[model samples]
Target chain A: MRGLLFSAAICLATSPALSDPLPSWGSTENKSTIISFVESVTDPTSPDYVTPADRIAVFDNDGTLWGEQPVYFQLIYALDRLKTKAEADPSILTSDILRAAAEGDLETVAAGGVEGLLEILAVSHSGMSVDAFQDDVRAWLDEARHPTTDMRYDAMIYQPMLELLSYLRDEGFQTWIVSGGGVHFIRAFAESAYNIPPEQVIGSAGPTEYVDGQVMKLPGIDFVDDKEGKPVGIDSRIGKRPIIAGGNSDGDFAMLEYTTAGDGPRLGILVHHTDAEREFAYDREGHIGVLNRGLDEGPDRGWVIVDMARDWEQVWPE
Target chain B: MRGLLFSAAICLATSPALSDPLPSWGSTENKSTIISFVESVTDPTSPDYVTPADRIAVFDNDGTLWGEQPVYFQLIYALDRLKTKAEADPSILTSDILRAAAEGDLETVAAGGVEGLLEILAVSHSGMSVDAFQDDVRAWLDEARHPTTDMRYDAMIYQPMLELLSYLRDEGFQTWIVSGGGVHFIRAFAESAYNIPPEQVIGSAGPTEYVDGQVMKLPGIDFVDDKEGKPVGIDSRIGKRPIIAGGNSDGDFAMLEYTTAGDGPRLGILVHHTDAEREFAYDREGHIGVLNRGLDEGPDRGWVIVDMARDWEQVWPE
Candidate 1:
């Protein structure tokens, strides 16, 4: 369900007396476009009006909803898990890849590639019940702060994006996070951090097994919600193509392509992180959430490009 | 969204003058229990009250909601596809397995096992756009008839189950179909047949490929929503444990167990097809949707087993 405040408030961009729906977003094209699209779609008198059930909006998580600088946050969580598990059992360090991961040997871990990453992930996440895994993730998220800025990871979420999500929800839209990150990790905090419940969060998943009357995580990746996989996930899980989709990277290119390509009044958006003064700025050669092709073709493809440096009055949520 | 009738519905089980919500269901405990459960959960003053958003109920499609006897309709559709394709491109008949499948050789197909079945599915389903596949399924459903009964496959759906679905929806519940059937096949008629939109149908899925800027079905089965996979699929897709679950096979044991094991007012139901005169009755030795373990352990586990011979007043919709 949408939040209780949804029915409790009325948001009008033209009315100065009403609450500003997107306070953190500057009065730029990015902000106005969002307000206009929502208003036109929700107006009962307009032909562009969409029913509440058809008002679906999907967002990418890693770099779009939260910071993914230095490296992807999930990778950091996996590395930390290696250290903690090794300290407890030490026997888990017997595997060469696990041992390297435990020792913080990034070079060796990188050399192992997808196979090595999956091996490390298996060791770190498997052998636990679904509840236990969720609890473990919750506990870690509560304490884990970004190394660069020392801010809690949830606090690193973009203020403007948060406003946009809430505003969309207020307009009778069912907002969803379509992420490339691990599903369980995102589920643990998404409800609290984004007000988007676990049910509405779609992401990459590790295989799950039901053993001894409990659902447990398995070693290997079952589905990846990156690149082309996003549309697949949306079709299978949501069973409907989203009318509005936003992401910050090329990994989400297909998702944006699929979402906006649908008939009539669809919105596709990209967040361009060009604010080096606030957050790290890298695109073509960025280690995470590379925005190369999206940047080059975004305007040509009719996607709204939110220039992070110019579109926002603030970045991270305080 | 639940239908608009829900807002207009005012259910009071005690009132005799009100229109019977489930006209196809007899006054047996199977029907009464369902009504009572719904009443208690929906009563504002009752301790069993569950909010509208939390009133999630899941149903299995194959046998519980519709007929799966004489082989699943999806398999039949796949076989028809094999024959039609073999006619167009005679060279496709060269593969022994494909030829056997096209010839309706059940003995040989069964001997080929799950791997062989997937091979047949890949050949039958792949290389088509999502829209094209959906249209193909819709066309097949329109013309395909049961071999013996000569009834349209969709016409074989249990009237009582359809009433239950609508009644549950009328009670402010979000009804979902969690099946082992292919989602596309179900989506083609689910809304028309049961009033359930595609967004609420979860099923076995093949991998999806994004090609030529369109999402298309890939050849192989990516995940099977049977046995242990039921609970896993429910967790990933619904993101919440359903309060009520129903099915007709041992394959659904995990789903019923998981749904009812949770705290608070929960219900597990099994549809026992014991009416040989109206519908085929088979249990332990049946080829499809066998009901051996669920029949034996249902009562002990507090599951409500509906005897089709006694509980249903009407079998199929007139």
Candidate 2:
């Protein structure tokens, strides 16, 4: 009986069907759809097959690949930095929004909206070399933990999305991160957390000064890669239309539209934050990553809306 | 006797020494220096060995990779485009510079300086979709010839540089074109001319608007990727410092400085055009690709100044 059990276990281990590429994803329609899309584009015999060089897959960083609850992780880092700066020299916190951010008043800071947040970010994140800023981000990521989950911020990356990224890469798609977050902030952790290189990560950036052989982060927004700017960023950076685009917000609507509108087989995926128990669930009314346009029009556009609760077998990686 | 001759020919064909990677380059110190630099960084046993992901090599487009004699090929294209536009509607040539440009008055247009050239570019280049702009560039490259060389502009690329690009790529380096030319213009032929993909080509760009799923190139320069801006462009686009940088002019001085200043094995190559008999040779006092700063300080900074006439066995590809 023991020999027969061993034989059965060996048979199961070698079975191709059991070797799922996306183990973190449940055997749901969303998972099947994603697999089908990848297979269709990768299979040489398929009519919709795309060349490997043209197979670009882009993902939004904040809400799409990771949790964006209790405000953005970047904002938290900025607030923390602001506090430290205020502790060292109180004169840095000139505005009320800056004061609120420095004081760790989430309510007041959140109420200040994007303009106020940009002001804080420009102040807290600039005046240092790019390398220094990146080092600071790396240090913060290493030390900082989620307020509620207590996990390292980098560890909060979705296991299912990681699996998807790996799967797509395995299928010859060059995975990229197109985010509304700061390029430096995303680049600092993107490689370690998501296995995406800094060159492949595109995001909002500030004007930088090349001084004394160092690129200093200047105190001004160069371009905000959100909403319509996402597509523009995609055009300027990639110089080619992405075959696959994944996001979780209205900010990604234009990107999805632009990607899908391209004359070929393209995939637009919207990660619907449906699992409140596993991750924070907010969309239309959410302060960050609002998805009103996507939610209302995604289905008609043939976009795959992955229900996080129903589709993901696991949220965080083990 | 016939068999002996055949055997000798076979031996010569199979000899590793005969398999020179840079066939277009002469047996010069520049070639050996370039090879040694590549070897040190690529050899795993070497102390200066770099990982494949970090093996980035940036190059300037206009004079470094190809001939930019008389004027930039892009300006020639813009002038040709201006003529066509003027023939259709003369009212479009409102400014003296535009009129001079349309009438092919090189002297008058040249006297107007960079400001005049920019005004002409902004007017002639905008109001078209990026795709359309690229298509126009492609069409121009297909038909346009250098007035002096009488060869197609794309065909005028340096054969030695082509070999160098391929050899570096073979050695696991990601070769990128960081040009002062328009991104759209460079992207059109970069992939075909140099085997460099569009995403790997960084350049100056105008603002773009996303309309009806098409990215429209709007008027006004967003950034000039020359001089100090080269390093800034490298930071924003590539997000990592290059290990190797190649250029022909002072515009590339900052880029070369930034690349070599990074803590690693680095190589800075300046292509000095000294082959007036074969290719136009104008530097230090040339209207385009001025090289006073690079000529003055490049040797002290350990930069390889490749005398084009001496180093290159051939100019244009066969």
Candidate 3:
């Protein structure tokens, strides 16, 4: 009995937790094609075998990894923060946007313009150490609710991509989020939400200052990683060209370009938000999550366009 | 005969250059110790077995991986560029530092202050795409010589570290350079000198701008990855905490701290410049490559302090 116990312990220590295959929850002909191609490349016996060194994969954060409906969850969190601060000190009420946010009128505040949104984001995100800001993000995420779904912001993350991350890890691929969002904001919840650690999350950042032995990372009005900056961020951060790139909009076009340029069996995937009934769907004309250029070039670039309406069996977790 | 011909074709198609363990041209003890540690971690049956995902290793650029004697090679390159620009414009001669740089008196230029160095770096580095900057760096490095060594800066690199990089790669460790120097400067020669590709080189950067249809990465007056910024850079870029971190100066303290704080078996090494005969040895008070606080706390922190005077046989490539 002791020998058997010892053997079980040895096995447990030696073997890593075997991750499940890429979520086929959104099973479709397109998804199957991608899975098969990836499997072939990873198989050592196959002619298209890729070594682990060449197995880098990158994912877009917003529409690709999680839902960005009604409003960006971070923006909502910022608005709430602004409201609370205003309640504490009525001086914030002097601003038109802050007054709108205080009244819980998100549409009016949002319609006030990018300047107004920047004002809210700057005030809420500035003047804190990265550690402190992360703690705040964690606290807010734990307590805050989505204005529409009422689900936790983290819960709104797509189930398919979460499965995809696990599947990729199992296949010896390192996955990273190359997003235009705040790096720390996503990094705080990435581990809990998707099993990705803080180091693996790359995003836009403001200038960080080391003051009095504390490192304070402030949200810069200047976006560090966005649009064309996406490719630059990936280049600066990952240093390796990703073999697989997935996204839903033009923000990811440069990333797709950079990834597909690698000399290997590369995959570029674009998630098309086509299911209006199950989830929000607005493409081409939509201000947010625009997918026009990517949609048009999908066929020419050999990018797999995942039709959410047809592909996903379920969108979010129960 | 047909079967033999088919076999030959298959071999030709599948042949990736067979990688061999290179001889680490160091004393028997250092070579043996390095080899044994690498072998143990690589062996699947060993207790220290590290999977490819966890096998990230980082190297310091200046003195640890390469020779930075007399002066940093990048600074030399910047000074040279400054001289060339001054020769063309003559108006650049208005500044005392520019005049000093034009005269090839680096000490005089450096004495002018950090602001002087910033002025030289800004004009020499700004107004180019990262690709263009990399190309310029490559062009300069291909011909630039170490004033003291009278050898190409590429040839001035430590051979043991080159061997270590190749050896780690063989053992499934992804090698990266976390330097306080310019990213483009290191990237220009990393691929050819250390066999590390451009993407794996992370270094100090300036603000970049994307305007109209062109992307321009300007060398910022403010350095992005330096001192405490080392860990921030590593966290921001590589997204993986290094399992092994090596450095020569106090600048790498934060990187060592971050690397050692990781949840697995980790190694932190400090290269002490004790060999004044082969290489300049002036730590604590040295202007370049100073190993002050690192030397003091290295023993307490359990960091392996490699005394160049006693530990290394060769300082530079033969």
Best by the DockQ measure: 2
Per-chain TM-score, chain A, candidate 1: 0.93
Residue pairs with backbone atoms closer than 3 Å in model 3 (clashes): A199-B239, A239-B199, B206-B220
Error of 2 at B143 (Å): 1.4
| Candidate 3's TM-score | 0.76
Please give, for residues A230-318, the per-residue lDDT of candidate 2 as tens digits.
99999999999999999999999999999999998989999999888999888888578788989999999999998898998899999
DockQ of 2: 0.69
| Chain A TM-score values, per prediction | 0.93, 0.93, 0.89
True contacts kept of each: 0.66, 0.75, 0.29
Task: Give the range where candidate 1 chain A is weakest over 10 consecutive residues by summed lDDT.
Answer: A4-13
Which candidate, 2 or 3, has the higher lDDT? 2
Q: After superposition, how far is residue A114 of candidate 1 from its true place, in Å?
A: 2.4
For model 3, what is the alpha-carbon lDDT of residue B8?
A: 65
Indicate whether candidate 1 or candidate 2 has the larger DockQ.
2
**Per-residue CA lDDT of candidate 2, range B103-179, in tens?**
88999899998889887888778999999999988988888877877899999999999999998887788999999
TM-score of chain B, candidates 1 onward in order: 0.93, 0.93, 0.87
Determine which window of 10 residues in candidate 3 chain A has minimal summed lDDT: A15-24
